[model samples]
Target: MAKSASSVDWLNRVFGDSKYSDLTIECGESTWHVHRVVICAQSPFFDKACSNGFKETSSKLIKLEDDDPTIVREMLRYLYTGDYLEQTKEGEEGSRRSALSTNVHIHTIADKYDIPALGDVAISKFSARAAREWKTEAFAGAIEEMYTSANENKEPMHKAAVAIAAENAKTLLNDDCGQAFRKIAEAVPKFAAELSIEIVNMKEKMPPTFARYRCPNSMRCNKVNMLEGLGQASGSRTCTYCSNQYYVNVWVSKKLDD
Candidate 1:
């Protein structure tokens, strides 16, 4: 069911005003005055923590000293609103990379707190940011974080990363801009293997006309190798503009010419 605007506003006010708040969630020096019904209903960990026999049941407080305060705040926000805005730290406040990192952290922490829906939301946000910023250094950092984080629900995030990397292989594997990407390929064997498989799968579905190759003489060479154009079956072709020879593959319907 869709939530009414008034209800969302009321909930936001509850979170903001702390009206009749029954539970206090403390992370580092920060605290969220929340309610048991609102928070516990969505998080199994919090539900268990606030159940009878737990000290928090009587104390009405849960301390999360180990979690990042910014992440915790976003988590609380999601519990109330069913969504969260990116909350990057000072230096990174507006950058897409920072937003990507925030989503990655939220995914892992959502898993930690047994909030599967929140984990899914985090991955969705992570993927959107990743698609836009895959060429940036932030992508490599996010990949490392995704692999290193102790989260069990990683397959969706893994597929998203590998897909982005596979689709942009020329820039991600051959260009100097991809140095960090190459380093990540070396550091994470699992990611490297998954990316290789995705690349192979992508190639199997691609048509011959989609193949592209750079002319040896110039960086500005037209990369398109559409069969309908001057492109032909594999052999040496001299660049008309640069007079340099380069190899092109037909990839289908023709044999390699000597």
Candidate 2:
């Protein structure tokens, strides 16, 4: 524990002070003064950037392009602390949405920089935040960005976003944030199809207590009266909507009584 505390203190000092920093990393108009050793120890991209043959080695300056400065700052923080700090707002909902958006951006940056551990950390945070903030517009944007930028199968964020979207299909497809669903459909047709199928399957597979039984003609059926008459027996019920027959099998769990 003493060694761990000492290491934390060392990292804090290194991140907090620019006194011994030998390198300057510029992103857009923003400049960050940092230690080359600290960055190189954590990232192979920096390892090569600070090597003898690189221009950064001679000038001790590296300029990054096409990267958000906010995300870059968090990336540096993760490099030093092994965790990225989330900035929260006044409202709980707003803060959570902001954190989710930031984590998605950080994950993208981490992947771009080949920092797998940092990417994993960012995605873990993103997944947790997403579970709470999935209904927000920020989550929609994050999902759009994740599908458009990140590797679809390799990134956990993509799958988590899809799962949340699937579970909340009614809200996501019909609400004000329906544009996100449309964007996903346009950007990734295969994923959109899969989500649609999952949503249909979910509605169909729901228990009688929670689900509205639908007839072949898309009309709601009185499942309770139908089930009461055919207790413990498998039979076909005629749909009142279309007069089509469908089979119904009831399976009650013994644990339901407990």
Candidate 3:
């Protein structure tokens, strides 16, 4: 038999020696427990703007489904107190889970839970660390922050996050998401050119087979306009209804777009 990540005595405990201290919340929804709780609400502005037939997501309490749900709990733990570093350590197992790395993971969970205050703390704390940590678990959280801002980023918090993402790109550059990375890099032109160079180098090292990406979105795939004089089988593709060029990549050999 193998021991799951859970099942360990410490798995049931909080990141540190923190307890299920009594807590209260009042807003859209209120949910708290011995270990953790969740609170969320739909944006009223969105609802009112297109009110022809809009409804709000009712407030509801949510709990962890994972047996060893330390990741989420720890983030919530930080949300309760801006001082994750100062949280009192727990018994025998306390030594096992003490590290700046754990705090980084908690930051990710906090971002997932829409806890901005906790996320700011995570970013501020992790910003000073070296590159190794950013490329690992921290990368995902940074990307999440970018995506969140893309939708609607307006505040001092977003400004700080944008700053960190740009600064870290020089060390954290990866080719897989070059487009997204470029967008983030442009935000901080202080070293944009150098950062872009690193991104290009990493992209160049990737295998050619990785070039073609499957379109995963639900939108319908259609002909792309093969650029003029490009000489693709799609015959310099053009479409009046949807696009100006045929999806050149999808066109058959020997024929031009359109």
lDDT string for model 2 (1-258, tens) is 012666767887788377998999888777888987778977888988899699999999989988876678779887777777766446632344467778877777777777888878887888787778777767777776666675433447666677778887877777876766666666777677768777888877765442234443334543322223233447666554456676654222111221
Best by TM-score: 1
True lDDT of residue 51, candidate 3: 40
Q: Distance from true position, residue 235, model 3, in Å?
A: 56
Candidate that beats the other on lDDT, 1 or 3, i.e. the better one: 1
TM-score ranking of the models: 1, 2, 3
- lDDT of model 1 at residue 160? 79
Candidate 2 lDDT at 227 equals: 27
Model 3 C-alpha lDDT per residue in residues 1-258, reported as the tens digit of each score = 222445433433533333553222222232334222312222122233224443222322233343124444455444333345512366532344434444445455554445666656665665554233444444444544433433232333334434554556654465554455555555645345544554566556644321222222216544333333332234344443354343545333323323
**Model 1, 1-258: lDDT tens per residue?**
335788778788888457798999998878888999988998989999999699999999999988888788889888888888765556743334477778888888898999888888888888788788888888888898898888888888888788888988889899988999889989999999999999999977865443333444435754333232234456756555556565554223232232
Per-candidate clashes come to 0, 0, 14
Please give the lDDT score at residue 33 for candidate 3: 44
User: TM-score of the candidate numbered 2?
Assistant: 0.68
**Highest lDDT scorer:** 1
Question: Where does candidate 3 have its weakest 10-residue lDDT segment?
Answer: 209-218
Comparing 2 and 3 by lDDT, which wins?
Answer: 2
> Weakest 10 consecutive residues, lDDT, candidate 2?
249-258
- In candidate 2 the C-alpha lDDT for residue 219 amounts to 43
